[model samples]
Target: MLRTPAAVRDAGRHTAHNYHPLPVVISSAEGAWVTDVDGRRYLDCLAGYSALNFGHRHPTLIATAHAQLDRLTLTSRAFVHDQFADFCRELAALCGKELVLPMNTGAEAVETGIKVARKWGYQVKGVPAGQATIVVADGNFHGRTTTIVSFSTDADARADFGPYTPGFRVVPYGDLAALAEAVDEHTVAVLLEPVQGEQGVVVPPEGYLPGVRQLCDERNVLFIADEIQSGLGRTGATFACEQDGVVPDVYLLGKALGGGIVPVSAVAADAAVLGVLKPGQHGSTFGGNPLACAVATEVVRLLASGEFQRRSTELGERLHSGLRALIGKGLVAVRGRGLWAGLDIDPALMSGREACERLMERGVLAKDTHGSTIRLAPPLVVTPEEIDHAVAQLAAVLAG
Candidate 1:
């Protein structure tokens, strides 16, 4: 008879019930695969929600982490660390921005962007104090902090996390007219995800980003693009906004920035918009620490080479083509671009959670977002054959 694994039982006993994880206990991971405690291997289709874009323990990132650990790790924001200047400078160049504010997580970066936008509104845009407003979309997922979740459309993330933060407006995800109607003179910023990851990899309309940029420019509002999950090389471009020829006033970046080694997020913007932040107004203890900087600087250098972006573009086509063919079989629809995809399973067959569980049993690890939608985002290092393998497994799971 089969027995439950001790690792799984222990994990459930010890940890908080915040995450309903799969029954497998991952002991280690490399490239696009993770091994359970019993030595079973599974293709990692989630890629840590696009965090491990370079794959787990990438050599360059690990080497940088090791070297930096020996020399120094933390200096907080109180004193300048050796890695501070290079990370800030390179990340700024990557965003085509004049300045960078480092933070530890995606939530912190989102909060930082909000604070900066409000300050910029009051100082530069000549808006009334405490009256600044920001416009957001319906299906956005910025982060889980109290302030960030206050604007979340997801009931689970937002409910009971209030009295919610005010001064933000929610409009439809891909409607330009609704957004235009929502924006007014008091609007300080228009915050959006170029491709909504948690909302089932939902892609906005083709011209939506450019339209937002035009509207923000016309209204003197900062266009803040939350690129934490959709940025880096996951979307086949350095930033998803590049696909639409739109340049946001502020770029909130995280995920792959730390090369899956450390938690590092940053808000990048021109001096005019970001200059509103004075010292002690915002900070993080481990935001741009030596280890994070060293790892992230290499991530920036890797992105600068353009190889990973090209891989995502070419390999993503192979992935999407395979998935699109399966739509009528068990998948109702497929959304997303580059290496990212959301497969909406036929409700008659299974829920997204059930599909993910089946895939887990068959050695593939994808995650369900909501209802019948499952998201597939393998590491950028995934090969064409591996992509084929993952898709084949999904086909078999559906067939059963």
Candidate 2:
């Protein structure tokens, strides 16, 4: 019988079997590498689903967290803390928005956007309560919350979790015509990921986002962008929406907002839209806690500093070009923006999971989505030499 590590066995026995994570038991991580309990190391190509855009355990974020911890931790929404205003201000400036509402997770940020849109529809757009409809694209992965799962196109996510929240309409992704047909007077917002991260890093057509923005403007509906998985310099820009020069009415932020050290997320918008929520309307106990606020503040600064964004852009081009050279050989195609690339493999030859497993054996770590597509989103801090090494490992894996 194969013996498993005590840590791994203990987790399996005690924890809910919600996730089917890779078998490697991580013991520690720093920068772009993670070491397993058995002392093996691998380049982290997933970056915690882009949550580690700053790389793991970044010194600046750690220092900030340490100082803040000594000062204070949680004060709840019952009272304000010093880090709260700074976090909001910095995040708003980073998003180019007028106001921000802090939350603790990507799902909460998304949920907040939904509530704000509905409230705006009732109070400002004159839609009746429980009648405001929000349009969402198919193949989107917002989060695991019940209300979020209600609109998911993925069967596994929606399978047994329901009584399902209502008031959402589904439209075909990348089809502007479908979206145009779906929207009407009662439509409050269009919530979508700029690039569908979970659906194999699926990128929409060039004009899709700009077109959606225009359509929302024409219909007087709010354009809500769920950038939790794609924003904060993940796609070589501060926000993925910047690629099209479209400023969404509301931006849902999470993941990398915590710099991979804490749970930090927020929703940013102009006051008119987010302002619809009165004091007692919505909040989270840990939202904008001092520790989260400090870490997120550092994250926003690093993202806006343009260092990591440039690295992601430069290395992204290198990685994509290298991977594209394998087309018609092993990879079917490579598609994505910046450091986030999706490798579509020949299904008959090997599944994406197989490719990732092979890569793992060769000292690289990545994840597969859908079945044939593997996503590669290494930390923005990854070096050119590291990129070459990772690509070489992947090339060898495919060649074998």
Candidate 3:
């Protein structure tokens, strides 16, 4: 018989101590629920940090993956595959961009965006060679890449990752004045998450995204929206920027793009911006492979139907409303859009880690960030009852 404690301990015995996972030993998952190795069940509220926006092994996505797996999988960028053009065309259409450059991870997409922006800076924007600067926001979580971490304000992510890459500037998020001041002659792009997911699903002030778009246009800089966590129906819209009534010059997308099955990411931009890349400039072998494209193509189809987006909009109201009702009871604050939310548990009562552990014991899985902030991003397939149950579990944890 598989036991939870021994399984959990053995699971971490050989791996790097990078993640501090919960005590639950999940063996299989379907939709919004998972079964532990010991046959215990729990609700998955984190949703793979939005990677499972469509839910675990969604039928269509799984079918597509299986079909593609039986066929071709990879051909590299050297030769075009059957699934390449359709995925790019559909995703570009979804993003309202002229071209899409595929990669295998969100970090790679970020890196690709940086490279493209710099190349566009020199080739089109006429910035001095090797002096192009991309301004980013503080409290941002782009990725763990050294270059992306260079402008990160999080000490844990930024520390010891240097001598950090230069040519990037960090400004306080949601502060248009600071951002405007930071943009100057050599500024190539302003990269930001329309909604900061890792910093506890933090949403900026209203009009902030539009103001950035206007500033980027006025400054001849690219507005790169890193929507890895906020796009593809996670934020009650196709993209979170849409909530603020703005469209960025470039879209850095990943996470949910692969339907939680494979790692897939892409950077979408108009020809004038992305055309700066020549052959042999930047490429990924697994990017746009048949399996990734097949799954992502289904993902695009799913989002195109607008069902998940609508679910996020309608259900998010319920989730947020329930969370707000607990403000004085235990939660200090709640912030997010759609089904994505970050709850700040009253630190005087208990830390976020403790809250998550307690919630875990109650068969609800959640993750905590910073000190007292808990992020809840249940799958879009999660029903109203599941949301209420998760919220009730949270209330119970707080009451105790």
* Model number with the top TM-score: 3
- Considering summed lDDT, which 10 consecutive residues are worst modelled in model 1? 1-10
lDDT of 1 by residue, 1-400 (tens): 2233776788889789989888888888988889877788999999999999999889989999999989999988899988999999999999999999999899999999999999999999899999999999998999998888888999999988789889999999989999999999899999999999999999998888999999988888899999999999899999999999999999999989989888999999999988988888888888888899999999999999999999999999999999999989999999988999999999899999999999999999999988889999999999999999999999999998
Model 3 Cα displacement at 385 (Å)? Answer: 0.4
User: Which residue pairs show collisions in model 2?
Assistant: none
Please report the TM-score between candidate 1 and the true structure: 0.98
In order of appearance, the predictions have TM-scores of 0.98, 0.98, 0.99
Model 2 lDDT-worst window of ten: 1-10
TM-score-better candidate, 1 vs 3: 3
> After superposing candidate 1, which stretches have Cα over 4 Å from the reference?
1-4
| C-alpha-based local distance difference test score of model 2 | 0.91
- Report the lDDT tens digits of candidate 2 across residue range 69-175: 89999999899888889889989998888999999999999989999999999999999778899999999999999999999999999999989999999999999
Query: Over 4 Å off in model 3, which ranges?
Result: none
Whole-model Cα lDDT of every candidate shown, in order: 0.93, 0.91, 0.95
**The candidate that achieves the highest lDDT relative to the unseen native structure:** 3
Of the two candidates 1 and 3, the one with more favorable lDDT, higher being better, is 3
